[model samples]
Target: MDITLKSTLPGHQNPVFCVEKGYYADTFFTAGNDKGVVEWDIEHNAFKRILCAVSSSVYALRLIIGTPILAIALREGKLLFVDVEEQKLIASLQLGIKAIFALAHMSWKNELLAVGEAGTLHVIDLSTYQSIYEKRISTTTIRAIAIDEGLGRIALGDKDGQVYLLDSTDFHVITDLKLHNMPTTSLAFIHNKLLSGGRDAQLVISNPNQLHDNFSFVPHLFTVYGIYPHPEAPIFATVSRDKSLKFWSSDDFALLKNISREKMQDGHHLSVNAGAWSQNGQYFFSVSDDKLVKIWEIKKIDKLVANS
Candidate 1:
């Protein structure tokens, strides 16, 4: 299937680092190396405002569920909370001396986890905005993080191609597995399994508890930049440096369709740096180094059967 470019919203002075959907409105937030977070209104197809600014490049951003607050991570190891509706700075915290790479929020417990370039995890309580627990994993840089509310687990992937599972409540290390030879770039939980992508040009699926076993890798044409699961379907999308978005069936890891920027004729001309699936899962958005954003609608599939 071909991807149609809906529109292009260009305002960032540098490459975008992350894009997140707003919890309470029809808006989306994007953070980039320009040290600012821009709020884009999807319904209007344009940017509404530059929500906030930081001292250094914003490397990570996460929207807390059921709140108007946003967690912004800076390259200088500072995390700030911005109230989106009122456009005010709610709070701010510093993570000592290490640069933060990823951020995740636990909706159930209202806790925020920040991972640093040194593979240190800091768990912060939203109510008091205090650090409850912290752990360091040797000498690896944490690249990605995912929270599993169902199993009370937090997954952390590092630059050395290792994934570590820890108890979300106590921050105890549960298990550690070396999953790839290259840095793990992204992680997503789908269908009772964990999906991971990395610079090794491989996508892997495995059980979160038993990461050392029951693992499978599928080779890709280019470095896998991001992997996101559909909200309500049995499929997910993978973005690569080759400028192609491929949809895969989660059950069997089969490629269902490929969407390339060239096919859309939208002048999409950069390696995909980041991509995200909407909350409703009906549409997906991707941002590239070429300074363009493209949204694609997912097509439903019908089963075909024949009498044997």
Candidate 2:
């Protein structure tokens, strides 16, 4: 597959911690050490508005589908519910845990899930905006969480190099496997398999039903911060502290492309923290410690295909 740089946007003054794909067309939100949550109008290439600015670093942001509400997780264990359209804070809560590094909207249960430094996971009801449940998955810091809404499964990765698979409905542990020897930084479900990456600099694929069915690769030179699957295609993207983002086929774990200024001139100069893929699979947005958000698209495929 061929890719091209479409746009490089500068907004956040500090490292952008996260970029989330909003429900609205051509809209997404970004936040980080800048302590500000800014929404962007991707189609128009302009800033839409600030959701909220906090005293602490905003580590994660998740948009509630079919609603204007956004859940913001902070570095100091605080959670904020913001009305995105009105650009105002709706409610706030102190999680009393630690820095929250991951957030997921569990629509099926009308709850928001957050995990972080304390090794605790908090489930907040969207309707009541209250913590209904909290559980400790490990003694180590939890760095990533992924939910498979259709299958009712939740995956959690921690600093101890463990991956916990649980049933979202009851939060029952299905399997707790040591997939990495170091901190597990990213988790996702792609093509019916659980994909995990870590500071071990390894990406591992495993089937939930069969422990024997697994695949692993040392794809990067440093910590892997994020891994995002394509909306429709059999591919995914991973960002690392090695200062690069790579595309891979989910089916066979094959590397398709490496994206970086070292490989291509238009890539990020620092470590890429996270990335979000558009709903249509036409474009990708990546944020980095360089304080830049880049938009990438598949460079005209027809001509390349014809020539081949």
Candidate 3:
């Protein structure tokens, strides 16, 4: 399969940190140093409209399933619940004085999870919109969080390159391991194994079931910011400060392809921070420091057959 750039949409004035697909899949939302959360209709290739503009950089954007509400995380330690359909703010809360870098919904428990420089993992009950749990996981910034419902595990990565594994039910620490010399930049869970990458430019694979067989590799030239699996395919993608997007075989961890201006005619001029896959696994959308959102697709190559 060959990856090709479909379109480059420009509007943000600064680096775009996060990109998330809307409930409809064809629509996606993005925000960053520009401080504006703008939704885009990928099917029509048009801007849906700006959802909200906060006073600080929007570092994370997550959409609540089956609703028009969006969870917006800002660098000023504020979490704004915005009604995207109405373009109005529904509710807001100050998470802390330090910036919030991550926010995600724990669907199984009906909770909204957020963490950042404050070093506390905040869990809010979605039904009550009340803080249900708070735990200090680290003294430094928590850069990434990943949940595995099947394994009942929660993984938190901090700026100190330490990965904290906890029980999803009680939020009790299971194990803590130092994986890199620099900050742990991203985290993802596949088949109950924790996959973590860092500013040290390394990717480490650790399995709770098999504690002694962990492995590591250098996957990028610079910091790896995001690692996400395809919605339906057995493949995953990663974005980096190295200014490229790469695909990998999920089963074997083999490099599939790399997209970059140096390697491909169409690539980001600046660091590519994040990427999201279409719900059907047909396309991808990525945001970068260059202030652009790019749409990409994987094209199948047809080979000619000869009859003897």
Clashing pairs in 2: none
Can you tell me which runs of candidate 2 are displaced by over 4 Å?
210-212, 299-308
Shift in Å, residue 202, candidate 1: 0.8
Instruction: Give the alpha-carbon lDDT of every model.
Output: 0.77, 0.86, 0.84
Better of 1 and 3 by TM-score: 3
Query: What does candidate 3's lDDT look like per residue over 228-271, in tens digits?
Result: 98765667899999999899877788899999889987899999
Name the weakest run of 10 consecutive residues (lDDT summed) in model 1: 299-308
Query: What TM-score would each prediction reach against the true structure?
Result: 0.91, 0.94, 0.94
Clashing pairs in 3: none
Off by over 4 Å in 3: 209-212, 300-308
With candidate 3 superimposed using the best TM-score fit, by how many Å does residue 200's alpha carbon deviate from the native? Answer: 0.7
- Candidate 1 local Cα displacement, residue 144, angstroms: 0.6
Tens digits of per-residue lDDT, candidate 2, 106-135, equal 887889999999998899999999999999
Q: Is candidate 2 or candidate 3 better by lDDT?
A: 2
The top-ranked prediction according to lDDT is 2
lDDT of 2 at 304: 33
lDDT agreement of model 3 with the native: 0.84
Candidate 2, after superposition: displacement of residue 26 in Å?
Answer: 1.4
